[model samples]
Target: MVSSERLADIGYKTFSGTMTLYGGYLCSLRVYRYFHHREQLRIAAENQTEDIIKD
Candidate 1:
């Protein structure tokens, strides 16, 4: 049987670890948004070029 203090300590560690993982997920989401935005811009530019050629 674990003592009360040990259970509290384990809970704290788990909380901190979960927070760290959440931070990393946020960072990756930002990066993904940036790349997604860039790709969209590239596609728009290509479409514009096609329009110009047609005109």
Candidate 2:
């Protein structure tokens, strides 16, 4: 049989589940933007390095 603490824990889990999902989604978006920005910087650096080498 489920005890009172178990029931309360389940309730907390349910509430936190929604928060966790939303937090995860926002975190993923931030990570995606960070990676995209880093990729652009990497490409720009490579181009600059090549230009310097050619000069």
Residues 1-55, candidate 2: write the lDDT tens digits. Answer: 9999999999999999999999999999999999999999999999999999999
TM-score against native, each model: 0.79, 0.59
Mark the regions of model 1 whose C-alpha exceeds 4 Å error after superposition: 1-4
Q: Candidate 1 residues 1-55, lDDT tens each?
A: 9999999999999999999999999999999999999999999999999999999
Q: Which residue pairs in candidate 1 have backbone atoms (N, alpha carbon, C) closer than 3 angstroms, thus clashing?
A: none
Q: How far is 37's C-alpha from truth in model 2 (Å)?
A: 1.1
lDDT of 1 at 37: 100
List residue ranges in candidate 2 displaced over 4 A: 1-16
Name the best candidate (by lDDT): 1
Model 2: residue 20 alpha-carbon error in angstroms: 2.4
